[model samples]
Each structure stands twice: as C-alpha cells, then as structure tokens.
Target: MDPFEDTLRRLREAFGVGRTRPAEFRAAQLQGLGRFLRDNRQRLQDALAEDLGKSAIESDVSEIIMCQNEVDLALKNLHTWIKDEPTATNLFTKLGSAFIRKEPFGLVLIIAPWNYPLNLTLVPLVGAIAAGNCVVLKPSEISKGTEKVLAELLPQYLDQSCFAVVLGGPQETGRLLEHKFDYILFTGSPRVGKIVMAAAAKHLTPVTLELGGKNPCYVDDNCDPQTVANRVAWYRYFNAGQTCVAPDYVLCSREMQERLLPALQSAITRFYGDDPQNSPSLGRIINQKHFKRLQGLLGCGRVAIGGQSDESARYIAPTVLVDVQETEPVMQEEIFGPILPLLTVSSLDEAIAFINRREKPLALYAFSNNNQVVNQLLDRTSSGSFGGNEGFIYLTLPTLPLGGVGNSGMGRYHGKFSFDTFSHHRACLLSPAGMERLNEIRYPPYSDWSQQLIRWAMSSQSCTLL
Candidate 1:
C-alpha cells in the first residue's frame, strides 16, 4: 500500500466537499497556525538548534516571527483577499456583473528546504491555507529535528482533513510527485527545482519554484568599508551563511577589496567573536555532507581570515576568501555556507558586465554612497530583489515580494502575493435574464447596423469619455 495515497485522497476528498471554503474556516486555520508558533516557540527553537544549530534569537527573527507575521497578515486580510475583485466592463456588458473569483486550487503540495525550514515551509503553507486549498507539507528531511517536530506536533494545530505533514527524502518526494496536485510550491536548489518543474509538468499542474543562486554583492569605493562590512557580514553569516539570498560573492576593485578585507574581518570578529565556534550566536552546518562540501570550498582562494572547520561539530568558522577567480569552485556554485569570496573588478561597468554574464540571482546587492550607482545597477540589471546599502531586511516587510528570475526560480510569494499564488482567478460574469434586448446584438444578427453597434460597444470608446 502506498503511504501517501490515503492521505492525498483524504485531503482531496475534503477539498471536494468544501470544508475549507468558508472565510471563518480560513481565519480559524490561520489563527491555529498563529497559536502553533506562539505555543511551540521554544520547541521549535530547540528543534532548529538541534538541526541547524540556530540560536533562539535567530530562529525567532528569521523563521518563527516571519511565519507569525504572515499568518497575522493573512488572517487580518482574509475577507478582503477572498472578496470578488470587481473589474470594469465594456458598454455591452455594463448591465452585467463581471469580477474575478479567487478560487482555491484544490490540493497543493509544498516542498520546503532545510536552510530555514520553518520559514520556507509555514510561510507558503500560510498562503495555501489562506487561499483555501488542502495542503500536504513535505518539510526537509535533512532538518530532522524540525521535521520531527513538524510531523509530530504541527498536525495537532491544523485541521487534519485540510492539512497534513509528510515525511521523506528524495525518493519519497519523487514518489509523491508522481501523484497529481492542483498546484505545487517548491523551495530548494535550482537542480531540484528542475526536477519539481518536470514532475509538475507531468500532471500539467502550475508550480511556484523558490530556488536559490549565486547572489552577488558589489561594493563601490564611495561607500564606507566598515558600514558595508557590518551589513554584508551579518546577512552572509546569519544562518552560518546558509541563506539563499545571502551575498554569495563580492565584486569590487582591488583598492576597495583591500579596504573591505580588514573591515569584513573586524565585522566577523565582532558578530561571532574571536572564537566563533564557541559563540552562541553562531550556527553550525546542517550535516556532514554540507560540512564537507563547504570545507572543500576553503581551498578555492587564500583564506584572508577565519578558515577553521571542526567535523565533529559540523562547524565552519565565519570565513572570507580573497583573490578568488571567477571560474573557481566557490564562485561556480551558490555558496550556501559561512564562506564569502571576493573577486576584483576594475570598474562599475565591468562589475555589471560580470553579473550579467551569469544566471540572474534571487537577490543582488550594491553598496555605494552615490544614488546614481544604485539606480544604474537597478535599471540595467534584472534580479528577483535588489538591496542598496542593505542586506535582505526587505524580507521582513510583507508588502514586498520574494522570488527569483531565470535560473534562480519562478514566482513571487510574501503577503498577498502568497495568497494569489495558491488561487486561481476564475473570471465570472452574470447577466440579468431580462436583458434579452442587449443580447441580440451580440448574437447571430448579420445586419450592418447591428454589426456596427456591436463593434462600437466592444471598443474602448463606448465604455467611457476619452
């Protein structure tokens, strides 16, 4: 017997019966989600610590608080979001009601990654529930502690008929993908994103892929090295540099690089302390696999500061590498760890050209006192998100969207964008039964006068004053 078969069927059956369609039910679910975070704050923090060595503050700020905020936002605006969006109609349809109905896309599958397990999982789950879809959440198996907590405890807070948590790694995920879902939302690497896309294609299901890439951060000579270093180092090594949107590499002139090196080193020491491995704020790598991978990257460039690794603890000290070539292994892939590489580019145009030559990143950063440089980077380049003299603090704002372009991924989610992604905007129009007279012109009337009238009614000119 297939393990997921019964659960998927049950959720689909529940969705078909409209158990989650009511605004009250959605609000209840959102409230329940809120309670789960509030009630299990410590439990979740412990789980995150065990899995990723996340500090309690880091877990709350990045994962728990964000999820809570999303749930609150969705609950507060559930009625407004679900209300029929009224649209303008042409002259011929002026007497009819035309609007878009935000209907749920039945069964949804949310595949989350391990880096920030709770945030990625529950954030999208909040959207799915708000949009009134039955959801099956597959939290990352790699984050076993969080996974266990989610599987064992999260279901207690949600309606089992409408929501479920599944357990598995790649094989089970592959099997799960074989089944059909109305929509799929995946957050992971571009490599796995392609697999998810391909699986979603088999059933002709729409998907929102939140994948990561080599997000670049460019520093200009006009900026203060210490300030820039403080901002970059904090975000780059926040989750032990396991952030998808973290500045993967740095691009600046050799002169600026020289200034940045010591500043970055000082910032790291300040943030993680001289003995970072002993700091409570610092996190360890997820597992041996990732630890080994990150440890190998240390050989790419000369370690300017802090290139220490402990296999037993899965700890990699907050490290910065200099003189890294563009073709180096550290630069070739998304360095999703506590390692930052610096590469020299002589001019702003060269830096722009260098970034343009690569796959569009999930997020891009530029540090400069000159607003024109920031604007130029913004206007000339394409990325999912851009940070000017900042890091990914924009994520905390629900008004802004988080997504990717090109090889990074597809689709945006955060706040209302999340609600929209899980919904299908069904176009609906209701005409009065008594409006038979207006219908004749739109029907099989071949007369010239009727044709002319129909054409005029269909055009924008007849709708209102120009």
Candidate 2:
C-alpha cells in the first residue's frame, strides 16, 4: 500500500478544482504563512535550539526573518507577478496580442535540509504558495524538533486541503518520491540530489536541486586580515559551519596566512570567548553521525586553532587547519562542519587555477582591498554566487538569485525568482476573429505578386500593419 497516495490525491483534487488559483486565495495563503511565523516565533526558536543548539538570535536572524522577508516580498509583488506580462511581437504576429501568463504547476514538493531547516522549508513554501500551487513539504527528519513543530503546528495555519507537512526519513522519502509531482525543489548534498533527479525522471517531473560543494574563499595579501577573518569566521562557523554556501577553505599567500592566523584566533576568541564550548553563542553539530564524521575530518590537516570535540554533546570547536594538501580528505569533500582549512597559494593566478580545477561551488569568496584583484577572480572563475570583500550577505537581498551552476546544483530561487521557478510561464496569443483579411496572406494559393506581398508583410521591416 502507498502511504502517501491518499494525501497526494486529496491535494491534487484540491488543485484541480482551482481552490488555489485565484489571486485572493494566493494572497491569503501567503498571509497565513506570515502569521504562522509570527505566532509561533518562540516555539520555532526553541525547536531550533533543541535540534541544532542554535541561539534565539541565530534562529531569528537566519531562519525566521529570512522566511518573513520572503513572505512579505511575495505579498508586496503578488498582483504584479500574477498579471499577464506583455511581450513584444514580431511582424509575423503583428495583429495579435501576445503575453506570458504565469500559472502554477498544480502541485509542488519541497524537500528541505536540516541546516537552517525553517528557512529552507518556509522560504520555498512562500514561493510555491504565492505561485498558487498545492504543496507537500518534507522537512528533514534529522532535525526532529523543527520537524515536529512544522508537522504539528504549521498545518493549523494553512488550508489543510492545499498544504501538508509530511514527516519521514530516507526510506519514507524514497517511497514518497515514487509518487509523481508537478515540481520538486530539494535542498541537500549532490548524492541525494542525483537520487531525487533520478526519481523525478521516472515521472518526467522538473526539479530544482539546491546541492552543496566545497565553496572556496580567496584572501589576497592586499586586504585587512582582521576584517577578512571576522567575516569568514562569522559565516564559516554560523549554524556550526553547516551552511552549504559557507567558505570551505581559504587560499592565500604564505605571508597573508601568517597574518591571518592570529586574526582568526582573535575573532574566534572574541566571538565565542576563551572557552568556546562554554559559550552560549556557539552551536553544536546536528547529530552523532555528523559529529563523528567531523571528528574524523579534524585529522586531515595540522590544526592551528580549536580542535576540541565532545562526543556526548555533539560539539566540535571553531577549528582552522593549516598545511593541508589538495589530496587530503578535508580538501576533497565539502567541509559542512565548523572546520575551515587554510591552503597557501603564491599568486592570484594559482588561486584561480585551484578554484577552476574543482567543481563550481555554490558560493565563492574573494577578500581584497584592491578592486581589480577581486574583479580578476570574479572574471576568471565560475561559481553559483560570488562574495567580494564579504560573506554570504547576498542572501539577504530578494533582488539576487541563489542557485548553483554545474555540480553544486541547478536552478535559481528566492523572491521573484522563487515565484517564477514554481510557476510556468505559458505563452499566449489572442487574435481577433474579424481579422480574417489579415490572415488571407497566410493562405496557400501560389502567385508571384502574392508571394512578394506576403514576403514583405512577414519581413522584419514590415512590422507596421496596414
């Protein structure tokens, strides 16, 4: 028996009946989502703390606020986004009105990751709802607290007919993937992404895979070591360094590496204090599996700072590793924990070569006072997104898109891009029934005079209708 069959059928019926098609219905759904976040803010924060040891501030800033902003953006632009977009016509269709009508894909599946669970789940939900689709949200089972909150509390705020929160692990997810969906947006590793892609292929369903890669951070000698360290440290260790876009490794000259070491130590100490484990600000690894995995990675390179770990607490310190080789395990995989590796490069060209050699990362960072050096790195290498003299601050803006290029993943989403991704842009043309005279030129009676007239009428220069 298919466990998800009944639920999927009910949602499909709801969507087919146009319960989610109206602009008012979409807006109301978005507003309800906003209320869910606002009404249950504390509960959500507490869940995050329980699951990942995130402080209230980190939970609010990284998850709640980001989700709220997306909801607000969708509401502010919902009417504009739903209206038919007028498109320029060629001479071939001068008398007809053509435009793009954005319609929902009927049903959407959003499979979120454990890291920033609320943000990843709800942000995409905001888009799917605003685009007028019945949605199935599969929150990460690893983050049990957040998953419980979503399963128990979230459905109360949404129309149960159209929105659902299904809970399960890998086997259940595999079973769920067997069902067909109009669209699927998954956030996780590339290996799982491939699995999702393959499952989606069975039904010919389109997907948006937000996968991770070894995001490289390049620090040039021209910059302030303290500034780079602060930015890198804050982002790298944020959410216990589980961010997909966080800088996985740093490439810089030996001199800069020397200068950066102390600055990084200062930042770590200042942020988390002399004893980081005791600090309330620092979070822990998600679970024992991840903790053991991160502990194993700690042996990859010579530790320059913070190599401490507590298995019982699932805690790994804000660690920095130096004298690491490209062939080392730390450099080979996406370091999704609080471990940052520093590998020295003699010049800018070497850094670019090193970055280009690897799979294009989801995010790349280049810190330099000189604009040209940053620009050179930007022009030379390719990544999903580039951060210049900063970290992943670009995610805050709705104007920019968040996605990957090659191995990192495919497809873009966030704000308007999110709505577009969930909605299908259907090309439409409306022609007047009385314009049979204008259609006469397209009829098939062979004649030299008519041929020249038709040719001229269909030409680019003949766009003006007579």
Candidate 3:
C-alpha cells in the first residue's frame, strides 16, 4: 500500500471522521500544538542535534522558538483571519453587496527540506490549520531523527484527522503526490522543486515553492570594513552556511577586497576560534554528499583565509576563497555551505553588471554607507528579495512575503500571507428582494433604445437609474 495512503488512513481514524469544517476544532488544535512545544521543548532540541548536528542554542532559537512563535501568532489572529472581508461593489453592481470569504483548501501537502527541517514544516502547517485545512506534512527523510520525532510527537498534539506527518524517501513522496491534494507547499533546491511542480500540475493544484539560488553580496569601498566583515561572517557561517538566504559570494572593488579579507579572517576566528573544526558553535554539513560538494568548490578558487575539511565527520571550517572568476564552479552553483567566494571588480557598475549577467538570485545584499550606491543597486538589480546595509536579517521578519521569483521559485508565505496563500478568496454578492427591479436593464433582449439606456446607465456615476 502507498505510505501516504496508509498515513492518511491512520489520520482519518484518529480524528474519528474523514473531514470536518469546525473552526472551534482548528483553534483547539493550534492551542494543543502550542502546549506541546512548550512542554516538550528539550526533546525537540535533542532531535535537531541528532539529525543535523545543530547546536542546542541554534536549534532552540531557530527551530523550536520560531515554530512556537508561528503557532502563537496564528492563534492570536485566527478570529480576524477567519472573518469575511467586505469589498466595494462597482456602480453596475451597486444593488448587490459584495464580500470575499476566506475558505480552506481541503487537504494540503507540505514537503519540507532538511535544513531547518522543523521550522520549514511546522510554520506552513500552522497556516494550513489556522485556515482550517487538513495537512499531510512530509519532513525530509535526510533528517531521519528529526522526522521520526515529528511523526511521533505531532499526532500527540494535533487533531490526527486534520494534521499528519508522513515518513519515507523520494519514492514515498512521489506516491503521495500521485494522489490529488487541494494545495501543496514545497521547500528545497530548484532542481527538485521542478519535479514537485510538475507533479502538482497534473492535478492543477495550486502550489507554493520556496527554492534556493546563488544569492550574492556586494561590499562597497565606503562601508566600514570591520562592521561588514562581522555581519557577513555571522550570516555566512550561521547554520554552516546551509541557510537558503545566506550570501553565496562577494563582489567588490579590488581595493575594498584587500581591506575586507583580513577583517573577515578576524571575524571568523572570533566566532569559531582558531580551529573551527573543533569549535562547538559551528555546525557540520548535514551529510557527506554536501561536504564533498563544498570540497569540490575549494579547488575552483584560492583560499584567502581558511580551507580545512574532515570528510569522516562531515566538517568544513569557515572558509573564504579569493580571486574567484565568474566561470569558476563555486561562482556558478548555489554554494549552500560555509565557503564564501570573493570576486573583485574595479567599479560598482562592474559589480552590478556581473550580478545581472546570471539567473535572478533568491536574495541580494549590498553593504554601502553611500545612499546613492544603495539606491542604485536596489533600482537596477533583479532579485526575489534584497537587503541594503544588512545581511540575511530579512528572512527573520514575519511581515515580509518570503519566496522567490523566476528560477529561484514562486509563491510566498508568512504572517497573514500564509493565510492568504492557503485560502481561496471567493467573491460573494448579497442582493435584497427589491434590488431585482434595478438589475432588469442588464437582462437579455435588446433594442436600440435599450442599448442606449444600458450605455447611459453604465456611464453615469450617479446612483439614479434610467
């Protein structure tokens, strides 16, 4: 039997019914999820450590706390999100009152990636439930330990009929997609995202794809070298540079590169100590496959600061490579690891040109104190999202619509955006009994006089009808 089918069966049996539209039941489920996280916080942290080698602090802050916050935000705003929103009617339809009703898209499928596995899965699930939809969450099998824990724990807290966690690899995922779903949400690499999208197209089901790309960072001469270095080091090395929004490469003037390299070295050492391989703060690559990919990129550029690796433990130190050409493999692909490549250009215009020559990046960062330089970069570059004078902090904001465009991917979800994503905005018109007489002129059989009267009626701004 298909694993998703079996899992869906279990969920249906647990909920004691196949489906339900009770808002009160959804509220209770959200409240239960909040209580589950609060009570089992340590377990979640331990699972993250076993699965991805994330430090206790990183797991607590990024995974557990963020997931809990999403649940809390949804619970607080559910009443408003569920309410009907009245809309203004056009003059032609003035006799009827129009409103948009937010309705759930039946069963939802969420395919989450390995990096930040819990957060990516649970955050979207919060929106799915808040919008009153059933969800079948497929946590990444790459993070087996975390996936096992989720499969065990989620059912304990949520309404099993409404929410379920399915376990398996790609084959299982393919089987799950074979069945129709009301909506699907996927997060991972662009290559795999295409497969998900293709499958979703079969059902004509709407989807939200959050995929990664070669995100770029530009450091201008006017910026403070030390401050820029510190910020870049923090973001690049955070989660071992596995973050999708992490700066993939640096573009700057040759003179600025000379001033920035030493400061970057200082920041890396400060954060991870002399030997990052032994540092407790730095995380290891999730698996050997990723570790080998980073090792291959090191051959493409000269090591500016650190280039150390341990294949056995899946460890790669905070590495910085300089003098990397655009054709180099490191510059070509999305470096989803702790290896930062630096490409020096003579002018800011050259830097912008270099960025424009490639596919649109998921995120862009420009470090400059000059307002003109910042404004120019923002106006010219095409990216899914960007930050000026900062690094990867935009991903932390709950209000922003977080997703990609073009090759990076499509669709966005966060805060109220998620509610809108999982819902179908159905327009409704309410007309009173007496309003039928006014709409008679819009009815079928037409004479020349009636046509003139119809045109006059539409053209007139006054409420009076002819």
Candidate 4:
C-alpha cells in the first residue's frame, strides 16, 4: 500500500469510524496521560537526555512535567471547555435559539519540532484528544530516543486507535501530508512552516502554524537596571536560548546598555558560574549545524561578554554582543542559541519603529515601571502577544491563547484555545413555530411592494414584521 494510504488506514482503525465521543472520554484519557507521565518520569527524562543531551531538570521542566501539567489542566477543565457556548441572538432571531456547538475536526496531524519535543507534541495532542479528534503525531526524528519512547508508551497508555506516533524524517512527513486531514498543527521554523501551509492549502485544510521570529525585548531607561538584566539574562539563555519565544535580541538606550550589559554579564556568571561550559544548568546546541550558525553570528557583532564554543560538544557559552547593527546575521534571523545581541536606540519611538520594521514576532516584551510608557509601547506595536516587564512567561500561563500573526505564524492553541483550534464552531438556529410568518419575507417574490417591504424590514432602523 502507498505510505499515505497506510497512514490514513491506521488512523481510521484507531479512531473507530472517527466518531469517539470526545466529551465522554477526554477526561479519563487526560487522567491516564497524567498517570503515565508520573509513572514513567525517570524513563522519559532519560530518553530526552539520550536523544538531545538535555539535562534531567531541563528535560523535566521543558518536556515531561510540562506535558503532565497540560494533561492535568485538561482533565480539570474538560467539562467547562467542552460545553456548547450560548450566544446572544438578535431581534430577528429572538424567536429562535442560537448556540454554538464545538464539533471536532475528524483527523488531525501534528508536526512538532525537535526543541522541547515532548512538550510541543503532547500539549497539542492533549487538545486534539480533548476535542475528540484522532491524531497522527510526527515527533522530530532528530530526537529519536524521545520519539521512540513516545511511540512505544502512547499506545500502551492511551487509546491506540485514536492516537498514534509516526516516526520518520522529511520523507515520512511528505507521505503523511499527502493524505488530507481535517486540521494540521505545526510548530517549527518559518521557512518550513510556509511549506507546511502551502501543502495544506492544496487540500484546503485549516492549519495552526507556530513559526519562530527574532523576538525582541525592550529595556527602557526608567526601569531598574539590575532587575531587568537578571530577568533578561535568565530568559535569553534558558534552554540554551533554543526556545522559539526566547529573547532573540535586546533594544535599550545607549546609557542603559552600559548599565544593563554589565548586570547581564554578572547574572550570566552568577547563573552559570565563571565557566558556563561545566555549568549543569547550561545546555548545548541541539546539533553541530546550529552551533556553527551561532558561532558565525559572533563574527557579525562585537562581543560584549563570553564568545566561545566547543564544536565537538555542540556547546556555546552564554555569549553577549554589543553594538549590533541590523546588517548583522544575528539581528537578521532568529538567534536560536545561547547568544544575545544588544542594540542601542535613541528613543522609545526608535525602538518601536525598529520592531515594527520587522515581521510581527511571536512574543514582544517591554520592561518599564512606568505605566504610561508601557501603554504607549503596547498601543504602538503589534505582536502575537505582549508581556509587560516579563520574558517568556506568557507561554507558561495556560489560560492565554498563544500564537503568531503575519509571517511569524497563524492560528493559536493553548488551554481552551487548543480545543477551539481543533473544533469547528457549528451554528445551530432553532426557530419557533410562531416564527414561520417571519420566513415569508425571505422567500422568493418579485413584487415591488414585497421588495420595498423586505428592504424596510431588513433596515437597521426599522422594526416592521413580515
């Protein structure tokens, strides 16, 4: 059989005619997932370490435990999330009951990235399962150990017919995409995201693209330098700066830079110690290619603090660069490694303009104690989401909808948003028997009197009945 056909057949068999009552079974499945994660925490962490060389704590926080949290949250809130939402009806429809029914998209394909493989895959998986859809998960092959573990454990713990992991590379992904699905959720680089969207377009399937960008963090002069520096340093180097929402670069006034960079340097030293290479908290680049890419960016910008690497280990120290121009490669793209570029701006307007000049980022951050400055920045700039005086914390909150706009990405999914993402808001209008007279005005008729009456009745200012 063809690969596409094989995948489709497997999914169909798993979903049992693609009609499982998601509302009835999602809570139990989520509970099972939570238990599965708790029962096999050590094994999952070990697998992540083997696959990506992630430290135990990083693996736990970024992957396994995160998935466990999502499962627990889904289980706790499934009932409220799954209920049909009642909507306000207009006067014309007052005799009719109007409500929105959240119905599942039949089959969904989730293509997750290598960085935070488990969290990215399972978080969306929770939503798909919660919304009562069959899922075909394609975990990143680069993290083969984690991929293998998930493929093995998922079938055992969950409904095998409703959820299955397909393990392979680009070829496998290509085959999987050949068969049309009701929805596709992909989290990856912008270039790859575009390809996924284009392929999805052929089938007219809806998609949620969580693409990356050069997310910027603005540190205004009025803010406390030490506090901003500490937060910035921690977020910039978190997960070795591999996060899609990690502060890609910083924009601060030249005077603030003098104060901020030194504090940032101190924070980095404090967090990773004098030698970050041996620091347990510091992580390595996922592969040699990424290491080389980050190493190459160091040349484009002047080094402000620690610019070093170990290619064999795929290690790059928490490096900082100053006086970075827009022409620099680091400034040009998403610096998805342990590198932070600091650019000086003369005014907040200049900072806002710089951010506006680029594609809308997935997350935009501003650090200011002044409410007016915060309001101005929020009003002037547009992003997928904004965080005030915080970095990357927006993603930690399960309540907010996380996504991108413009080139950064399209569509969003998190908590209830995820359920909404996989669900089609089907509209139902039930008209009362007495409202049958109202329908006469909408029926086909060519009389001038009928046309005039119809126009008058449909006008916003008029309240005439048919």
Comparing 2 and 4 on TM-score, the stronger one: 2
lDDT, candidate 1, at 187: 96
Q: TM-score for model 4?
A: 0.93
TM-score of each: 0.99, 0.98, 0.95, 0.93
At residue 120, give the lDDT of candidate 2.
96
Alpha-carbon runs more than 4 Å astray in model 2? 464-466
Candidate 4: where is the Cα deviation over 4 Å? 13-18, 432-466
For model 2, residues 76-128, the per-residue Cα lDDT tens digits are 99999999999877765777899999999998999999999999999999999
Candidate 3's C-alpha lDDT? Answer: 0.85
- Model 2 scores worst on lDDT over the 10 consecutive residues at 457-466
lDDT of 1 by residue, 1-466 (tens): 7889999989999999999999999999999999999999999999999999999999999999999999999988999999999999988778889999999999999999999999999999999999999999999999999999999989999999989999988999999999999999999999999999999999999999999999989999999999999999999999999999999999999999999989998998888788999999999999999999999999998999889999999999998899888888999999999999999999999999999999999999999999999999998899999999999999999999999999998999999999999999999998898958768777774799988988888888888752
The predicted structure with the larger TM-score, 1 or 3, is 1
Residue 449 of model 2, lDDT score: 83
Clashes of each: 0, 0, 0, 1
User: Which runs in model 1 stand beyond 4 Å of their true positions?
Assistant: none
* lDDT of candidate 1 at residue 429, scale 0 to 100: 96
lDDT of 4 by residue, 97-168 (tens): 789888888889999998888899989989998898888889998877778888888778877667777888
Give the Cα error of residue 307 in candidate 4, in Å. 1.1
